[model samples]
Target: MLADFESKHSLYFDFAGARPLQFVNPPQQLEVKAGQTARLLCLFTGSPPIVSCWIRNKEQIVDGPELWTENTDQSSSLVIAEAKPQHTGYYTIVVRDRKSSAQHTLTLSVIERPEPPASCPVISCVTASSLVLTWSGPCYDGGSAILGYAVELKEQGHTEAGDWREVTDLCTSTSYRVCAGLRHQGEYCFRVRAFNKVGASDPGPVSPVVRMEQRVSAKPQAGEAPKRPTCVTMDSSNKVKDHYIMQEKLGVGKFGQVFKLTHKVTGQVCAGKFYKGRRSKEREAARKEIELMNYLHHPKLVQCLAAYDHKPEMVMVMEFIAGGELFERIVDDNFEHTEPASVHYMQQILEGVAYMHEQSIIHLDLKPENIVCVDTTGTSIKIIDFGLAQRLDANTPLMVMQGTPEFVAPEVISYEPVCLATDMWSIGVICYILLSGESPFQGNSDTETLALVTAAQWEFDEESFDEITDEAKDFISCLLNKDTRRRMCCKEALAHPWMAAFDSEDLATTKCLSKEKMKRFLARQKWKKAGKAMLALKRMALLSKGDSCSSPTSPGEKSPLSPEAKHALKSLEQKMQGPPHFTQCLEDQTAVEGSSVSLSCHLTGYPDPEVVWLRGEEPLEESSAVQIEYEEDGRCNLVLAKVSMEDANVYTCRATNNHGETFCSAKLAVKQ
Candidate 1:
């Protein structure tokens, strides 16, 4: 029984090997343009089961939505419905089974769609009462008469089916204006459809609903203070005051006052800021601040709960923090053990600051006072007061000097092009205060502090920071660099060894310290092997082309013999020979206006050469006007229909196979 099984396997292998292991179709000669469809056929036969693949160039076109297939006992065909110029390349049919395999190559050519004489442009609503429409015109169509266009309108809110209503007719111009006189509070929808002699196509998608309401005016009410500062309140006389007198006063400031209040309905504790006498400018700023806060949703940032215009009062409600500001926790004498408590707290602050920087937001006023520690455990910190914050794009230059005197970066003080790196500088100062229990640089007055920062003179007392790890010192030193260019960025700072304390306990200890340790550890060894292999290949290629008189001395001197090398050599030789030839035959080929045309190339070559067609330097497959056909004798014929001025270019036919490759060219002229 074993002997019989062995004989059967041998016979199966012989049959598979004997059958031609080759792609049956001319995979290279077909062409199609973008937005056009092309079909590819894979023909093969075998006694044992065979699997097939359609590959573009050499890469397999895996089964996907764009690639569909139909299989039969004799052949399988792949249909690509919308071939794009990106699809232009050499295609191959690969057939294989356990015993043997075969492949055939074909080149694909894609053409550009003809420019339409009149385009049906996209339409949209610019405002509630007006609709804006745009379109592109065709390049050439005998200047066909654009009698007019048909505008359609339909309301999405209509309960029953609604019929489209055509409005004013449009001329050859590419734009249209539509005005609505509907209900002031009602939303209306509109769309535009184009028409010509051929007939009208489907209408475009409906435009966004436009309302007919007047723009709401947001102005400060009378009896309000001029500066309605965020998180604070003020009286009509421009002094700190609370509109809701019952809520306990938490703090007072120049522009407003902060009140700890409870929601009348929800009974939830919240902080309220009321404007004393709202100036128009201050009211506008308050309005914008509310809009900005409404869109922001982050865990580390204080949430703006609500905002309202209470006639004579402009109020902003916010989440109340119980733990008070980081400033109080670090500076208050009662919190003497703040150092150990601040280690974890400082980490959370850095995390929140890093998040803001990632969002392209610069908390220009980043200081201990602005950072509120909400959790009673003192482990959480929330960045507050977006009033001074700005969404900074890379191109924007710092135009205004902002932030506290001590924590502000030198560039910010200098009114230079400060970026997110400025925030990093502030974070560094905060870190120093948290670790050393004192500010890194200080003075009795703002003027003295500015002088100290400008001079860049500060002492780092090693004794005072004995408990702080050297890693932390190095991290701070890198971040505190006065030169903005040299300052450590948020991402780089986050990746520093000191910041990796949570990843490994030993990382925070000095025992693992070594000069150039991270550099040597992260270096790759695989790159060395890759370099050696590349050098060896280059040496072999050079020796192969050496003078015949020179004798081959070493085994390495001999050309490396591999399956891939042999296959490449065979392929190169085949491409040198041209395609097979056959008699040229034509029935009727003519160029017509608003129509398509075809051109054919018939040829013959030995060893069945592969066939491909090209117009100018580009392959021509799926062109609205071009079609290719392959005959039994290996001859290819190209067909170009409704040929236009763009089609007037030299065309070529190329054929390549295992034995050789060749090509032929012809010119197509469009008659006036």
Candidate 2:
């Protein structure tokens, strides 16, 4: 029979029908920013679906750093996270089975940073009301072409102080004939800067101050009035849309939503706060914030690295200061930083503010929420949110009400001119909260809060202050003084005696808080979560009994729980000051087809461990046959719902933490 089949070709029937056709649909072309996630999707259809293998620029991929693969009944995917430029190039996916195979290919391009321009502007001509500027391209294009240039002007002898004010719209060409807005007789200086799709380049040297000379109206000099370059007022990063990849959204407000952003090439994480330009007021705030961050850089300040303008939406890629908000530490019951620790944190705050003031940038909004711990140690702090920051001179009058009501200075509430002193006032309030964990001006209502801030209606509560020191009180009073003249600047605040002691020897062992206070804080934080969990369970129990929720499913509906569900909801209520133990074991369980069985045990331990249910030495994450869940006090349940023969196995309950591990195992026999 084999010899006869080998001899015939055209006589063969439709065996295995269509030869198990496999079709692959990879993207024709894909573009992703560097440092973002890249996903390659491949799908197939046949009697027994497709098995796939992925290749990049010709090398087969495997489970390794930055690469992963997942497959389902009919689809499969390759995911590369924190993708880099080296990951770019040709990619191919081959889908095959016993009878047939097919392949799909595509090109991936990862956008990266362009080089900053190298040329400084040349002053070609100058007149009473205009200046003509010309420039050459950069040393490198930073992987992209130069898109535009920026022109700014400032007075010759101001405060080393005044920020450079952009005078032209982003010019599309190398030269811009700066027309209009020049002082007729006043001395002035000008500078030129360039930008590309990636980001802005440093500005070239400023032109020497020149007294404007009148130019009589005459026949235009040949090529004098060249075509004006189409200039846009927005930064190049804002105009060009593709440089950065938007990742997860973090929050939303009337200002706009915030997101976690990653720089495609560098893989740096940033907070992208989107300020909706849907309203003029909001847009102006966004622009001001960008302008402030553009020039300011300091260790204590949250750096605004880049800005993107997705029209009607503006995004700022800012520093991802890791430790979370200062308020969290304030509320943490376990946070028991003594006077020495508290003083160290305060000193850093003042140091950061000093840097900001030195740059002539005033953070109009200063509060616990706006400040964050930059490092895990929680000692290093960073100031965030320049949306309310302004480049104000001491005499610049503030006109609007901004900042948290609780932290706003008296000068802000009165609509008086805000200066560095205004921020110092906020620091005083922060100092108060830091020491005693109490708000100095917070009230029950917005009206009351504003009133308290305006009137400087705050005092050191005697009870809370007894544990605080006189030097600390003096430092707070000096900064919080309603009088702006005596208000301590960042330098003076840093020099305060209370802050000075932090630098003395033996500060760390000096204790952050009084012994009793430290213990109370730790106890407060540890038990709060456990207590809340207990309260929720009680409410759930009462609701379930009242509603008769234990009834079986009527029909065509999925049951809320399996018959074997170990609803040991009451087990975790007891506090565990002892080592974790197995109160209940798996204990040979028997269940019928389509029924559910649950196995659970109560664990007692200090500091909960990661609890897992395993089969032999293999830990189970989750599956259609089994699931794992736990309660606050360390009681965990392993539920095997919809029991089938495949569910038969020995299950183990294991708890592991920094301390050690404890486990209990039992068997389950499922009958079909």
Candidate 3:
């Protein structure tokens, strides 16, 4: 029996020598913002059956949702999806084997901007010339010392509340006196925010509105009264009609109606977007958009001149882009569509995207319809429609199924965590269409298209890409990579060979791409738009009826579950059915490098869940070395052929069915 065991388990025991547990890579001190993800890795190589666990402080860590540990015979990783101040501490990875044991430790620091001032300001010594107010330090200094306070004032009944004027810079004193720019008899509200090395915190609660008044020079005698002011100035209002005169309607978009406007003072033509309603949510969304516009400043981005509370609607005034849509220019009979022109537009787009990314903003919805030309020449462009834009931070990964079907990244379709690379994938699809006049992953319907996107199934048509340059193809490939880590960032893309070729004045390298197919693509898009409009109208009619059976049953007609409706319904069902559960969980496997290994599992879930393989936090796509198979009996297998040392790690199978997600993981130990 001993001889048989030794012969059968020879893969685990090294006959050559007794290998000792040792650290191949060790963890190091790490620092991250409070709301960011933090990862600590500890790698070791030794004999088989190495046991490892993570320890925080003196307690062993048990893997869970917010914080989890992945371990193999040779490696261990502690992942904090969203690091909090409490998570800042020393962490240890303890490894043990039959013959040896080892451990590694590291420190993690989670910092954030200071919290708001402790309480609202106390009003005192109110006069026309100066207003003195005092405040306390923040309740929390965000893991750092509070440097000072910043004050902002907003005059009541003048401009928008968000338009607060800064009073002073880094006022070390808790109390501040506002004197400059003070208006006599003006009503104003003041707010304060604390600052630290991490950054400035959100403003504290606003103080009660204060009314400024003139002071009496001396005590009044019996029956004596102070004289009234001789003149009074009315506060300026920020009504849309007061600032601009609305002209002809420019266009209609997903969130609002765009109209041409003339500035009352300068007589300059601009565009105003009037939101559909003044509901609280809609108003809040509009304000968020305005805030982003105020924060981001770039030539390639549509500049928000001003915003006004237009009664039932909120109107945002922006620069008038008269060049029409980029698609229109491509199909225009008189317009020239050359490779150089495409390069020019892409460069500008990258510049805009880079600016947004630098600000940690992701434009979730980036498509041709959102890109507009500045003039008929089509040389200048601006990216618009930021309704879906979001700021990415350390708190947690953003998971949203948004963006146009054909242009969305695979991660978007799979409801995976969206990162900066999500926008890169859209850019890739746009580039593909621009050069070939084709939508690379378009299918017969949106659902089919989304499925294609999830699979990363796309190929260049021979006819359309015949004239496209190899450099351009490579650029698109890098952007469309299934793994976000492998995708090119805006900065890298700007320096790509394809983009670099156009850095010089030489337009000689430019090749003219035939726009004939582009015209047809544009026509198809218009038809689809008209169809969508009809569908929206039909939906409204059905909604008015309030009948569950109002769905059209005619052949070729859409069902009640429109693509958007289906997603919502699926979400609801997911909550009802719960997450996927593994009936037969995966088991650990050991294999030598350059050998084949297979891990299998059985999971049960409703609505037919799709599996996403992950090697640590990064997802794995099907390739020659990795093959994923789904059996009819609900069994799934991940086969790794010719596995390398890099393939050694914790592999996870995450099953998601739109509404719910479940995951199981096991380690793969590869021996050299």
Highest TM-score: give the candidate number.
Answer: 3
Global lDDT scores for all candidate models: 0.55, 0.63, 0.73
Cα lDDT tens digits, model 1, 560-655, are 323433344344344334434444633333355445555665554434454556667766555456666654323456766666777777777765
TM-score of candidate 1 to 2 decimals = 0.40
What TM-score would every model get versus the actual structure? 0.40, 0.42, 0.50
Arrange candidates by TM-score, highest first: which order?
3, 2, 1
RMSD of model 3 against the true structure: 20.4
For 320-350, candidate 3 gives per-residue lDDT tens digits of 8898889888777777777777888899999
Model 1 accuracy (lDDT, Cα): 0.55
Report the error of model 1 at residue 432, Å.
0.4
